[model samples]
Target: MRVNAKSQKPKTPKGFIGPIGFDLPSIMPIVFAIIVFFSAVSYSYTTVNEKNNVLDSIESSIKIADILKGNSYLFFDATDSGAKNKFASNCEKAVNIAQSKNINFAATFVKLDSSSSIEWLIENKESEIDSCTTADGKHLCWCGFSPKKFDSNLSKQFWSISFPVTVDVKPPGSGPEDIYPQSYLRKIIVVVWK
Candidate 1:
């Protein structure tokens, strides 16, 4: 008996279109929709992860700064040897606090000396910084780094703040003119990474 092989159905390749209810054009939109949906989901997931990473780094840095700020601030005497010791102790405390939380850190104060020269001093320095007070450079301006030096910092998320050091939080005023003038300011810089 001879078989009519012409009437047999042919197999469709895995990725090729097969004879179905409609042509490929009708199904193209569904395929495109699935692709777009997945792409959107992936993009959103990545964006959220990046934002969380930045937020975490910044929050940790703030915690570290708060540790230092709370211990000894607003009274940073750049010219006094005793004050220098206190600053160093505070720096050690800040570093330890940060280290305990698994965060690497370094902090220093940069101020103008008696001769109008910049003094780059760290926490554990024994410099007889002459009375920097009368020389219009008595404020405590600080710079900090986390995970690495400022120049070698690899993290994209970081924060830096510099303002005149004041004994009062708001300068004891309520009017706009009473607002504190930005002069002889103290600088504080902080950076973080994941």
Candidate 2:
């Protein structure tokens, strides 16, 4: 018996004709995958950038607090409760320091377990809000510029920190026993904003 063989043409879908016609379907998955990958990458980049900004603000606030605490002019004597004649000058220096670092600074000396509070600010419009005052009308022995914002804009990144500090309070003197100074623990609140 003689063998006979015939080859048949591959079938093509209707209207599918051209050299690149079949390539579109094959390339679609690749194109879709690229779009998905890029979208994910872009989203991750934005999230990371936002987080970094927040972290930088937090770090700068901490640094400002440390600088204020270490400033000899501002906290001249941890034992001396009374402000020196140059105390205002020292606070201005602190504000200048914070401004140099591109941030705003504010400090509140709050007496523990008492309504007495002292605000250290630059005495500007923004600082006029009386952040240290309580709803019960906090008593202020001294309310003046100490720490301050570098800019007039109040809307910005802000952080606050409070720590304990010892201060010597001079009692009213009339007799020999009034000469001794009383020590009190005060809370120093440091606020930093950019």
Candidate 3:
């Protein structure tokens, strides 16, 4: 028996189209799935990034509070009023260092009176020391950046911590018999942002 070559070869059906590789219906689902997957991944990444920023801000704030309380650069021997130059220099340096690390820092000293009123000594500048009176009508000085400087419109994470600190304050123009400076307990608030 003779085999016909044309009969053995494959033949296209009548009205048959070209290859189905470019078919829209089959490609639509794949495109949709890919879009969904990428969207989910982007959202997850953004959420994680925001959470990390917040955690970093909190950690920095805590560390800054510890430094402010423990370090002698800002205040030596708990004497905030006597070390103005040293405080200013250290304050500027600390701020610059924090800024270099993409973090913002500020600290202030406050005293609460018996009448539930707050006395604030906000830091205005490195050279300018803001003074506030404690409950006992004693002056207290501090070196820190003001919280007002932080813009409300900026989308940044912020963290703050406040701790009690005992500071030595000298009465203005004390007599010869006044050899010891009065001790005042105050709060030091440290704020960090990114």
Task: Tell me the TM-score of each prediction against the true structure.
Answer: 0.50, 0.49, 0.60
Which portions of model 3 show Cα errors greater than 4 Å?
Answer: 1-22, 71-93, 112-140, 147-151, 175-180
Candidate 3 per-residue lDDT, tens place, 1-194, comes to 99999999789787557677458678899899999999999999999999888888887777667666655223322223335424345555566667766787767665533222122233342211233333444233443445564455542455767777765543445454654355556676666766
After superposition on all CA atoms, how large is the RMSD of candidate 3? 8.3
List runs of model 1 lying over 4 Å from the truth. Answer: 1-17, 20-26, 71-84, 111-155, 162-185
Worst 10 residues of 1 by lDDT: 163-172
Compared with the true structure, all predictions reach lDDT values of: 0.46, 0.49, 0.57
Candidate 2 clashing pairs, residues 3+ apart or interchain: 121-145, 121-146
Residues 53-82 of candidate 2: C-alpha lDDT, one tens digit per residue: 667666765665554444322222222333
Cα lDDT of model 1 by residue, 1-194, tens digit: 88878657675566774566447777799899999999999999999998886676667677766655553344434333244424445556766766676655444333333222121232322122222231243323332332323242443344432222222122222243443322333444444444
Point out the worst 10-residue segment of candidate 2 by lDDT: 125-134
Error of 3 at 134 (Å): 16
Model 1 lDDT vs. the true structure? 0.46
